[model samples]
Target: MDMSIVLQAGVATGTALLFATLGELLAERSGIMNLGVEGMMLLGAMAAYWVSAHYGVPWMGVIIGMLAAGLISQIHAFITINLRADQVVSGLSLNFLAAGVSVVLGEGLNSIKGVAILPSFTIPLLSQIPWIGKIFFTNQGILVYIGYLVFPLVWYFINRTRQGLHLRAVGEFPAAADSLGINVYRMRYLYVFIGGLFAGLAGAAISLSISPGWFSEKTTSGEGWIAVGLVIFAQWNPIRAAFGAYIFGALRRLVLDIQGPMMILGLANPFYYNPYFGFFLQMLPYAFTIIVLVLGSREAIKKRIGTPAALGIPYIRGERGM
Candidate 1:
C-alpha cells in the first residue's frame, strides 16, 4: 500500500500515452489527423516483441518498431494526402488492418518465449536523494529518459522554429500557405510520417518496457485511442499532453491498486462487493477519455480554438472548400 509504488507505476505507465499524444499533436499541427495511431502502435509492439525475443537486443526493438510504424503510416499518408481520401475513414481502416496483421505474424511464436525489458538507469548523484529521487529518477527504463528529453525539443521545434511556423500555417490555413508558396501536401506527409515514428516508439515502450514481454492478445488495449482523446484535453501542446497523459496513467493504475480495498468495501455493501464493481472501476480510464472529449470540445468552442483549423480535412491542391 505504499503511495510511492503506485505513483511510480502510474508515471511509468503514462509514458506510452505521452509518446502517443506527442506524435498525434505533431501530425495535427500539420493539419493531418492520423487516426491510425492504435493500429500503428500494435504493429510496432509486434515488431519490437519479435526482435526482443529472437534478436536478443531490446534497444534494437525500439528502432525496428519505430520504422515499422513509420512505414505503416505511409499508407495513410498516401491515401489521404496523395489520393485525397477521407482522413478519418482511411485512418480507421488502418486500425483493422494492423490488428489482424499483427496477430497473423505472431502466430508461430510461443507465448512462453517472452521478451525482455529495456535496461533501466538512474542519475549518478541525483538518485541518492530522498523521496524526490525515488519518485522521479529511480527504477525507470531508458525510454523514460528518452521520453523526458523529447518534451523540450518538441516544444522548441513547434513554437520557435521557422519550419514549425510553416507547419502550423499549413495546418491552420493550407490555402493561404499554398498561396504563400508552401507545399501543403508535402508538409502534411512529413508530419504524419513523423507522427507514425513516435507512435511506433510508443508501441515499443509497451512491449519492451511497460509490460516487458509479449502475449498473444492485443497489447495496447485502448491506450492509443485514449491518447487521441488526450490531445484535446492538452489543447494540442506537448507539455500539457504530458500532464494529461500522466493523469490518465494514474487513473489506469489506481483502479488496480485500489481494487482490493474496493472489493473489501464491497464485502459490506452489496453494490460495492458485486462482481461487476471491478469492471466499472476498470472502465474509469476510458470513461474519463469520453468526458475529456466532450468537455474539451466545449472548452475549445468557448476559446474559439481546440484543434488545427484544417485538422481531419483532406487537402486538395488548389481547391478552396471553406
Candidate 2:
C-alpha cells in the first residue's frame, strides 16, 4: 500500500480518461453527442501501433494516430451535422465501423510486434522534492503533465473566451445564436472535430504510452463509455473531470495491482478472492462511473448547471420551432 505507487499508476490511468473526457466535453459543449469515441480510440490505438512499429518513432505514430481517429470522427460529424442523421445511431455505427475496420487492418499489422514505448521524462529540480517528486514526477510520461496544462486552458476557453461563449450559446440555444449571427452548424462541426482529435490522442496514449504494444484486443476496455459518463458526472467541467479521472483511475488500478498481492498474503477481501470476481473487478471503474453520474445528476439539477439546453438537437436554420 505504497501511496506513491498508487498515485503514479492512478495518474497514468487518469491521463487517458482526461483526454477522452475533454474530447467529449468539447463536442457536447457545442451540442454534438459523439458516441463513437470508443471506436475512434480503438482505431487510433491500432494505427499508433502500426506506425510506431514501422517508423520506429512513437511521436510519428501519435500524429498519424490522431489523424486517423479524427478522420473517422469527421464521418460522424458529416452524418450527424450535415445529413442530420440521428446522432446516437450514427455514433454507434461509427464504433462498429471502427471495430470491423480495425479487425481487418489488425490482421496484417499484428505481424509487426513489440513496438517501443514512448520515453518517460522526469522534470529536473522538481524530481528532487521528496513526496511530490515521487508522486508527480517520477516515471510519469510527458502526456500526463500535458493533461495538467490542458485542463486549465480548456477551462479558460470554455468559460472565458468569446468564441467559447458563442459555442456555449450555440449548444444552449442555437436559434438565438443563429439570430445573433453565429453559425450554428459550423460551431458544432468545429467542436466535434476537436473532440475527435482528443479521442484519437487518447487511443494513441494507450498503445504508445501505457501498454506500449499493439494487439487486436479491445485495448480501451470501455474507457470511451466511462469517458462519456465522466462528462455527465463532471457536469462538463474540465477541472472536475480531471479530478474524477484520477480518482477512478486509482480505483481501476486497485483492482488490477492490489488483488494478487493481497490474496498471496491472505489479507484479501472476500470479494477480491472470489473465483468469479475477476470479471466483476473489471467492472469497478464503470460501476463507479454509474454512481458518480447518478450522484452528479442531483447536483446538476440543483444548480441548473448541467447540460446544454439544445444539446443533440440539430439546427435546421430559419425553420420554425425546435
Candidate 3:
C-alpha cells in the first residue's frame, strides 16, 4: 500500500475515534458512564447520510446527524441523571435502542439493505502540506477538521475554565460542590448533553468521511466502545485522548495494510481473523485502561495520578453514603 493511503487511513480513523473519545472523556469526567455511545453514533451516521442524500447539502446532513445522536444520548442522560436510574443500565439500554432504531429507520427510508454513501471535500492550502498534511488535511471532509479543532477547545474547557472546575467538582464530590452552591445535577446535565453532541459529530464523521455515505448493520462496529476505553486510557484528558486515539488508529491501519503469507506468522497477525483483528486492537485500549487503573490504584501512582474520587457514585443531596 502507498504511504499516503496508510497515512490517510490512520488520519481518518484517528479523527473518527478522537471525537468519540473526547465526548466520552467529557461524560466520564462528569461522573457518568455512558455505554450508549455506539448506539448514538449509529443513529447519527444514519441521520447524516439520510439527510445528505435527501437534501443534497452535506453540511445539513452533518448538523442533523449530530442533533440526532445528541438527542438520543440526552434521553439516556435524562433517565440516568434526573430519574436517578442506574447509569450503566441506562447507557446500555440507550445503545440497544439506538441500534435498533437506526436499522428500522434505515430500512424504512431507503427500502434497501443499508445507508447511502457520503461525499468528501478537499481544502486548498491545508491539504497541500507534506505527507502528513495530505493525510490529515487534504482529501478529507470538514468533519475531520472539526475533530482536530475541537481538541484544544475541549482541553481548555475541561482544565482551565471555572465551569470546568465546577464540572470536576461535581464528578469528584457532588455533595461538596452542592455545599458550595454548585448545581450538581445541572452541571452533569450540561456536560452529558455536550458529550452527546460530540458523540453525534463523531458518528457523523464516520458516516460522512470514513464510510463516505455507506451504512450497514455494523456501521460503527465497536468504535464507540473503543472510545469509552480511550477515556480511561487518557485519564480523562482530551490531549492524551487524542494521542491514544492516534495509536489505536495506527494499529487499525496496520491491520488493514498487512498482507501476504505474513498472516500465518504471529508477527503479522495479531488475531486469528483479519476482521477480528479490529476487535483485538479495540481491546488493547481497554486492556491498557485496566493496566492504568491498577497502576493508579497503587500508592505511588495514586499520590501522583489518581482517578476522580467520586466516579460512578450516585450523589444524593442530603444523604451520606458511598
Candidate 4:
C-alpha cells in the first residue's frame, strides 16, 4: 500500500476519533466519566444522515445531530450528577438507550440515496508542503480542518485560561470550588453537555464527511469505545490524546489496506490470499484499545498522573473533602 495514501486516509478517519476523544476528555476533566460515547455517535450519525437525506442540507443535519446527542447526554448527567447514581452504570445504561433509539429511528436511513455530503477541498499553499500536506491538507473534509484547529484550542482552553482553571478546580476539588462559589453542579452539567455535543459532531463527521452514510450499528462501529480508550491512554492530556488518535487512525487504515491483493515490500501479502486472516487483522485495533484501557486504568490509580481527583465520583453540596 502507498504509505501516503494510508496516512491520508488515517487522518480522515482519525478526525472522528479526535472529536470523540476530545469530548470525553472534557467530560472527564470535569470529573464525569461518560461511557456512552458510542451510543451518542451512532445517534448523531443517524440523525445527521436522516436529516441530510430529507432536507438536502448537510449543515443543518450536522446541527440537528449534535443537538440530539447533546440532549440525550442530559439523561446521564441527570442520573449521575443530580440523583448521585453510579457514574459508570449510568453511562453504560445511557449507551444502551441511545443505541436503541438510534437503531429504531434510523430504520430507513441506509436505503436513502443521493444525499448531500459535507464539502471537501485542498488547501492551495498548505497542500504543497511535501508529505505533510498530502496527508493532511489535500482534498480533506471541512471537518478535518476543524479538528486541526480544535486540538490546540482545546488544549489552550484546558490549560491556559481562567475558565480552564475553574474547570480544573471543580474536577479536582468540587467542595473547594463550591466554597469559592464556582457552582460545581453547573460546571459538571455544562461540560457533560459539551462532551455530548462533541460526540454528536463526531457522528456527523462520519456520516456527512468521512464515510458519508448511515450503516446502523456499523456506522460508528466501535470508534466511540476506542475514543474512550484513547482518553485513558492520553492520561487526560489533549496533546497526547491527539497523538494517540492519529496513530490509531493510521493503524486502522493499515489493517484494511494490508488485506488488498498486493505485494508487501517484496513478498506476497498473506492477508490477500487468506481473506479470513483479515478478521484477525481487523481485531488488532480493538485489541490494542482493550490493552490500553486496562493498563491505563491501573497506571492512573497508581500514579495519579493527569487524572482529575474527583473523576467518577458524585459531588454532594456540603462535602468538605474527597
Candidate 5:
C-alpha cells in the first residue's frame, strides 16, 4: 500500500477528529466537562445526511447538522450549569439520548443514494510539493485545509488573547473571575455551546466529506469517545490535539489498509489470505485509544497537570465550593 495514500486519507479522517477534540478542549478549558460529544456527533451526522439527501445541498446539510447538534447540547449545559448535575452522568445520558434519536430518525437514510457530497480539491502551487503536498494538499476535502488554519488560530486564542485568558481564569479560578466581574455562568454556557457547534461540525465532516452518508450510530463508530480520550492525550493544547488527531487517523487507515495488498515485506499477507483476521486489525485503533486514555489518566492524576482545576465542579455565585 502506498503510504502517501494512507496519510492523505488520514488527514481527511483526522479533520473530523480534530474538530471534535478541539470542541471538547474548549469546553473543558471553561470548566465544563461534556461527555455528550458522541451523541452530538451522531445527531450531527444523521442530520447532515438527511438534509443532503433531501435538499441535494451539502452545505445546507452542514448548517442544519451543526445547528441541530448545538441545540441539543444546550440540554447538557442546562443540566450541568443550572441544575448542578454531575457532568459525567449528564454527558453519558445525553450520549444515549442523541444516539437513540439519530437511529430512529435516520431509519430510511441508508436506502438513499446519489446524494450530493462535499467537494474535494487539490491546491494549486502547494499540491506540487514533495511528500508534504501528497499527504496534505493533494485531492483533500476543503475541511482538511480549514483544519490546518483552525488549530493555530485556536492555539493563539487559548494562549495569547485576553478572552483566552478569561476562559482559562474561569476554569482555574471561577470565583476569582466572578469577583472580577466575569459572568461565570455565561462564560460556561457560551463555551459549552461552542463545543457543541464544533462537535456538530465534526459529524458533518464525516457524513458530508469523509464517509459521505449516514449509517446511524455507526456513522461515528465511537469516534466521539476517541475524541474525548484525545482531549486528555493532547494536554489541552490545540496544536498537540491536531497532531494526535492526524496520527490516530493515520493509524486507523493503516490498520484497514494493512489488511489488503498481496504481500507484506515480500511475504504473503496473512490478513488478505484470512479475511477474518481483519477483525483483529480493525480493533487496533480502539485498543490504542484505550492505552492512550489509560496513560493520560495516570499522567493527569499523578501530576495534576494540564487539567483545569475547576473542571467537573459546579460554580455557584458568591461561593468558593468548586
Candidate 6:
C-alpha cells in the first residue's frame, strides 16, 4: 500500500477518535463515567449522515448530529447528576437507547439498507504542499481541521483557565468545590453535555470523513468503546488523548490497508465473514489502557503517573471522605 494512503487513513481515524476521546476526557475529569459514549456516537453518526444526505451540506449534518447526541447525553447527565441515579446503569441505558433510536430512525429515513455518505473537501494552497502537506493538510474534509484546531484549545482550557480549574476541583473533590461556592451539579452537567456533543461530532466525522458516505448498524463499530478507554490512557489530557487516538486509529486503518499478511501467516481472511477481528483491533486501545493502569498502579509508577485523585468516586457535601 502507498504510504500516503496509510497516512491519510491514520489521519482520518485519529480525527474521529480524537473527538470521542476528548469529549470523554472532559466528562471523566468532571467525575462522571459515561459508558454511553457508544450510544452518543451512533446517534451522531446516523443523524449526521441523514442530515447531510438531505441538506447537501455535511457540516450542517455534523452540527445536527452533535446536538442530537448532546441532547440525549443531557438526559443521562440529568438523571445521574441531578437525581443522583446510578451512573453506570444510566450510562448503559443511554447507550442502548441511542443504538435503538438511531437504527429505527435511520431505517425510517432511508427506507433502504444504508444512508448516504459525505464527500471530501480539500483546501486551496494548504492542500498543495509536498508529502508532509498531504499527511497533515490535503484532500481532507473540514472535520479534520476542526479536530486539529480543538486540540490546543482544549489543552489551554483544561490547564490554563479558571473555569478549567474549577472543573478539575469539582472532579477531584466536589465537596471542596461546593464549599468554595462552585455549583457541582451545573459543572457536571456541562461537561457531560459537552462530552456527548464531541462524541456525536466524532461519530459524524466517521460517517462523513473517514468512511465518507457509509451508514449501517456497523458504522461506528466499537470506536466509541475505544474512545472511552482512551480517556484513561490519556490521563484526562487532551493532547495526550489525541496521541492515544492516533495510535488506535493507525491500528484500525492497518486492518483495512494491509490484507495479504494474514494469508501468509496461515490466517484466513478474517476481515470477511468474521467481524470480530475488527473489534479486536479496536480493542487494542483498551488493552493499552489496562497495561498502563497495571504498570502505573505500582507505588513507583504511582509516584510518577498517578490517576486523578477522585476518579469514579461520588462526592457528597459535608463529607470528610478523601
Per-candidate TM-scores read 0.92, 0.93, 0.83, 0.97, 0.97, 0.85
Residue 281, candidate 6: alpha-carbon lDDT: 59
Estimate candidate 3's alpha-carbon lDDT, on a 0 to 1 scale.
0.76
* Best by the lDDT measure: 4
List model 4 lDDT by residue over 253-315, tens digit each. 999998875689899899998999999999999998988788878888898687799999999
Displacement of residue 273 (Cα, Å) in model 6 is 16
CA lDDT of every candidate: 0.83, 0.84, 0.76, 0.93, 0.92, 0.80
TM-score of 4: 0.97
- lDDT by residue (tens digit), candidate 3, 90-144: 9999999988998887764544334445445777787777777777877776666
Output the worst ten-in-a-row residue range by lDDT, candidate 5.
313-322
lDDT of 5 by residue, 1-322 (tens): 8989999999999999999999999999999999999999999999999999999999999889888888888999999999999999999999999889999999999899899999899999998899999999999998889999999999999999999999999999999999899999999998999899899999999999998888887889999999999998988989989999999999888988888798989999999899999999889889999898889778878877888989999999877465
**Which segments of candidate 5 are over 4 A away from where they belong?**
298-304
Error of 4 at 89 (Å): 0.6
Model 4 residue 308 CA deviation in Å: 0.7
Off by over 4 Å in 2: 108-111, 263-276
Ranked by TM-score, the better of candidates 1 and 3 is 1
Check candidate 2 and list the clashing pairs.
Answer: none
Deviation in Å, model 4, residue 134 alpha carbon: 0.4
Q: Give the Cα-based TM-score of candidate 6 against the true structure.
A: 0.85
